[model samples]
Target: MFSKILVANRGEIAIRVFRACREMGIATVAVYSETDRDALHPKMADEAYNLGDGPAADNYLNIEKILQVAKESGAEAIHPGYGFLAENAPFARACDEAGVVFIGPPASAIDAMGSKTRARELMKEAGVPIVPGTTEAVDTVEDAMRIAKDEIGFPVAVKASGGGGGKGFRVALTEDELQGAFEGASREGEKFFSDPTVYLERYLPNPRHVEVQVLADKHGNVIHLGERDCSIQRRHQKVIEEAPAPEWVVDEETRERIGKIGVDAAKAVDYVGAGTIEGLFSSDTNEYFFLEMNTRVQVEHCVTEMVTGIDIVKQGIKAAAGEELDYQQEDVVLRGHAIECRINAENAARNFAPAPGKVGSYKEPTGPGVRVDSGLEAGGEVSPMYDPMVSKLIVWDADREQATKRMIRALDEYLIEGLTTLIPFHKTLLQTEEWAKGDTCKELLEDKEWLKSTAPAEAPKPVVEDEDEETAESKYLVEVSGKRFDVRVVGPALSAGVVAAPANGAAPAAGGGRKPKRGERKGGAAGGPDLVESPLQGNMWKVLVEQGQSVEEGQLICIIEAMKMENEITAPKAGVVEELHVKEGEPIQTGAPIAKIVAAAAE
Candidate 1:
């Protein structure tokens, strides 16, 4: 085992790795960006280093700086955690060449599965079940159309070859939509993964997203833990995940088959350490198709751990240290059902808009069968520069039904003030009949009814009475130890009277602020009807409109990148652009002016 390990990630995952290292008696090093100086992960690590001040590319994704920190901190291993450089092959190779173990699969395994197109080809060659699609990257719209129409037929998926997690993925049902989907997917692939390559696959409209968790050792021993059902999603991103996928949906026979297939996929790449093989399972035909492989511990790995009682991270580290598997396939026992709800700093009512700010008054749920993996506290800040996820609420029970109910109880008890969260959404999702049946509630999330109905609950207002009026009915009940006394107040009631503010300690009333002027908006310090203010805090990625350019209502004017997601700022009404206040690549806060728009003049 390594004496020290450096975690090359951020947020909850970083903290998770730190906790694992602590339990194993291994020192942990944390690297942070400028915005994350006060982040919980850094505060919890044995030692911390500042990678730099800027976006992820300049900080967390800076392989050289991370390697430098590892060497300086005297760390012998680097755990990528997940996301960012987790699946980057070159970074793994760099760690290997630097003589520091990368606590993940070898670089060769990552390279084999990093690209979706290449992975599909390898899987097919290895006799693993794969979806019908092109075996190579689709170059142009013509190629995509040919592949979709001639080979895979219509309703094909155009996905990024170099990434997963719903990024750079689009589905086109008709030939006319192929061109747009192809271009959009390619653009997103380049922007997110720095890879413009893409490939086509047969799109499954209602197939469930099921995945198998596999652990492999350097001694060529590979075994799968079990399957997790991650079908509940929004915008193709998983919102909830559970292990031992409902027996009614995936029977024992299917589970054993998929587990072996998972091991086969890992062995094909000579994989070592912890990894996940995602596949799309069809209920209609009882068939499953390979989706992609995650090369590190997953966000939903907690649920797998809950059921299997395996410390996957520790095993991964041991494997990296040239250790062999301690347990065989028969030794693995999956017990109760577990579910994980990803609680993100987002407003479900407003299209799940990212809500990044200081978390005030955070009260996590605690009870039997409940666990919270979070990096935030009462006063910690959730910045827009990283993922919007605040925490993960994982619950376990003897069965799926009990787990569902327990999850609802936990979600209801979890409280996070000063910022909107998905608690209400999770509560609503768990209560649904479809969810109770272990069915993917994708449609429920997309339904306007729930989206419009599940806003954060409002706090109740305290009653205020006039001090003068309270004098007529002033009564006080006083208690001393076990004794109680009733007394009538002669003047205004003490509770009714407001305390005078200290000379230098006066506080403002709630909702006390300068009101916007007529035709002015809520965003920006100074803004009129014409000012187009940013709705969220993020870095300006692109400005679509120029000065004096005419734009219609709801037209996209600019793009702001926040929380690794891009949000498009649109025009309020038809108008001519007046002035631009922000430039490309500049960081912007909520209510910051993006541009000014003047109503178009009538002829």
Candidate 2:
């Protein structure tokens, strides 16, 4: 067992690993960029190091710097908590060379499964089912066109060989869209993964996203915890996940089969530690096809832990220390249903755009069957420099129905002021007809009108804007027994006709600063109906329209990259583009003018 372990990540995942290490009587080390100097993860660790300021490449993704920190802190192992360098084979090998244990699979295993194409090839040879697609990388658009038409057919998926978590993946519904999808996938692959290789696959229209969690050791002992249904997603990323996939879609028999498939895939690469085998499961045929493998702890692992009564992080660390797995296939069991909703700093009403900013009055729910995994606290900031996930709300119950009800209760109790979050979205989705019937809810997720209906509820403005005309009660400080107290005095003040006045709708607090307001729209006000405004803050990724160009109603005008998700801004009406206000690669603010569209009727 390692005396000290360093977590090479941030936010909730880092805290998660730290908590596990504490339980195992191990000291924890934390590293942070200057941007995260005061982050909760570092505050919770036994030792901390500063990686300087800048983007992830200069800090989180710098293998050498992290290794240096580990050695300086006397850490024996490093845990790359998902995302940045979790699955980077070179990072794992570097840890080996540095004589520090990497609490994940070997570099050989990561190399075997890191590339989507290579994983497909290996899975096929290992008798593990794979999605029907080209096994080899398609370098040129010409080659991709031929493969899509001659082999896969229309509605083909162009995916980066090195991509996961929905990045560098695109779809071509028809011949005209193929070239763009091909190039886009290749470009994103090179930019994100340093690989321009992409492959083709037949896109399943409404397949459910299911993943199985497996733990393996170097001693050849492997076992699966269970499966998680992650069908509820936005922009190909999961927003909600539940363990022991719904019985209606995946029965006991199907669960056992997929569980075995997961074990087989892990065995094929000699994988060790915690890993996830993501697959596209068909609700119709009850068949499963492998998507890819995540080589580290997952963001939604809490739901699985809640149901399985197993500590996945502890097992991963034990495996890295050359210990045999404690469980066999028969020993693993799932007790109850658990659901996790990702509480992100996003606005579902405006297409789930990222809403990163400081949070105020943060309050997480408590009581039985409810858990919150978060790194944020009151007055903490949700930096746009990182992912939008502010926290994860996980709830467990005897069954799916009760679990859902518990989740809703927890959501209602949870409060995060000063920024928009997905609480409303989760509350809305859980009660939908599709969710109740175990459907994938694909149509609902893609429906703009339905998404708009999930916007955060706001309190009505007080009718009397002038507080002077109001007779509302006011409080004043009064000393009592050497203690300070606030007392409300309204009787004589009302009779004396005392004028009242205040800037905020709610009276000021005892500390003097105003209580953080909710649903407050900042920046320039949106003007005329013909003028489209940016609904959220982000950088302009692409501007699809030119000034004076004609467009149909709801046509995509531009893409905004916020908190790592691309949001499409569309035309509000059929009109001619009179002017474009935002340029590509520039920062935009919420309510900032986007474009001016003169309605066709006026023209």
Candidate 3:
């Protein structure tokens, strides 16, 4: 066992790894950027170091800074939790060169599986079924056209060779749309991953997003821990995940088959530690095709842990230390159904736009089979510089129905303030007929009206602040022997506070309270319907239209990259484009008019 391990990550995942290390009696170290000095992950570590300032590139993604911290903190190993440098092959190699263990698969494995095209080729060689398309990179739009028109037919997916988590991915449903999708995927690939190569895949419209969790050791032992159904997603990224695949989507025989496929995939790559083999599984056909491999602990690993009763993090650490298999394939058994909801600071009504702001009244639900992996408190802020995920709410029960009910209860009990969250969305989603029948709820997700229904019905009651500071603290103060002492209670009370409870028994809505302190935004000037306003805060990654350019109704006008997701702002009506306001690579805010349109003949 290692004496100390440095977690090269932040937020909930960092806290998760720390907890596992503590249970295993290993000292933990944490590194944080200047913006995250007050964050929870650093506060929980046995040792903490500052990793410079600003965005991830200056901090978490800075391999040298992270390595320096590890060396200074005397950490024996580095655990790159599932983001930032988690899948970076060079980081893994750097850890090895620094004489510190990288608690993951070897760099070779990461390199082998990191590129989507290369992974597809390897899977085909290993006899694992993959989505039909190019097994090689298509460098030009011309090649993409040829591949889509002749090789794979229509509805082809243009995927960045190094993409994951929905970035650098686009779908072209027709020949006319192929060039745009190709260029978009390549651009995002170059920007995010520094890899401009892309590949085509036969897009499986509305296929179930299933993945198998595999654990392997350096000593040639690999095993699968069943499957997780991650079909509930927005913007092609998962928001909810459930274990054992609902039993209806995956039968016992198919489960065994997919389990073997997962094991085989790991073996093909000579993989080590914990990894996930994501696939597009068809319930109607009882067949699964390989999608890609995530060479790190997944975001939804908590649901897997709840059912399997396996401390995957601890096992991963042991494997890195050259430990043997603790359990054979026969010993692994899933006990119950588990579901995980990614609680993000986002507004579902506004197309799941990121709503980064400070938290006010934060409280987690507590009960049997309910777990919250979070990093924020009542006063914490969800920074727009990172992913929108604030926490992961997981629950378990003997069956999917019971698990659904428990999740509903847990969601109702969770209270977050100051900003919007997906709680309202999750509440409505779990109660729908689609969930009961194991449907993906694609229609509802695509329906704008249906999404609006998931928004909070009302804001909380106003909390007036008129009393003087001394006067407010006077009542909370207690003094002996005529000695006056100051004690203060600020903000709204947990109950009967500013918040108004929802009619569906869900958590109270945000955006109500007395003026106390931190976190405010710069409102952007908005115009009428003809003006295309930015729906949320983000960077203007690209502007697709120029002044006086004619555009059709609902045509793409701009792409706003917010919280690692690209939101395409479109024309509201058929007209001549004018008043172009957004600049490329500039910060944009909600209601900001990026462009405008008038009568086409007027131009």
The TM-score leader among the candidates is 3
- Candidate 3 error regions (>4 Å): 459-531, 548-550, 576-578, 596-603
lDDT-wise, the better of 1 and 3 is 3
Query: What's the lDDT of the predicted structure labeled candidate 1?
Result: 0.87
Q: How does candidate 2 score on lDDT?
A: 0.88
Q: Per-residue lDDT of 1-603 in model 1, one digit per residue for the tens?
A: 789999999889999999999998999999998788767899999998888797788999999999999989999999999998999999999998998999999899999999898899899998999998888998999888877888899889999898688889988999998987898789889998889999999998889999999999989899999999999998788889999899899998999989988999999999999999999999889999998999888899999999999988889988998988777999999999999999998777767778787877889999999999998987788888778899999999999999998999999899787777788888887887988887888788788777868886683122222323333323456777978756434444234236434233555233323434534654455877889888788889888889989999999899888877778889999989988898898899877888888988899
The C-alpha lDDT values of all candidates are 0.87, 0.88, 0.89
Clashing pairs in 2: none
Give the range of the ten consecutive residues with the poorest summed lDDT in model 1: 459-468
Candidate 2, TM-score vs. the true structure? Answer: 0.86
Regions of model 2 farther than 4 Å from truth: 459-526, 545-556, 573-579, 598-603
Better of 2 and 3 by lDDT: 3
Tens-place lDDT per residue, model 2, 1-603, is 899999999999999999999999999999998888767888999988888898889999999999999988899999999899999999999999999999999999999899999999999999999989999999799998888889889999999999988888999999999998998888778877999899999999889999999999999999999899999987899999999888888888899999999999999999999999999999889889999999999999999999989999999999999998877888888898999999998888877778787776789999999999998987787887789989999999999999999999999999888878899999999998888888888898899999999987782121212223323347666687998855655332333334444323554433322323333424464589788988777889899999989999989999887776667888988989987898998999778999999976652
- Full ranking by lDDT: 3, 2, 1
Candidate 1: residue pairs that collide: none
Question: Per-residue lDDT of 1-603 in model 3, one digit per residue for the tens?
Answer: 899999999999999999999999999999998778778999899988888778799999999999999988899999999989999999999999999999999999999999999999999999999999998999799888987888899999999999999988999998999998999899889989999999999998989999999999989999999999999988888989999898878988988999999999999999999999999998888779999999999999999999999888988999999997687899899999999999998989888988887777889998989999998887787887889989999999999999999999999999987778999999999999999999988888989999999998774222323432211111245576998645433333453434434334566444444444333435455678677787788899888899999899889898898888888888878988868888999998777788878877752
- Per-residue error for 184 in candidate 1, Å, reads 1.5
Alpha-carbon TM-score of each model against the true structure: 0.86, 0.86, 0.88
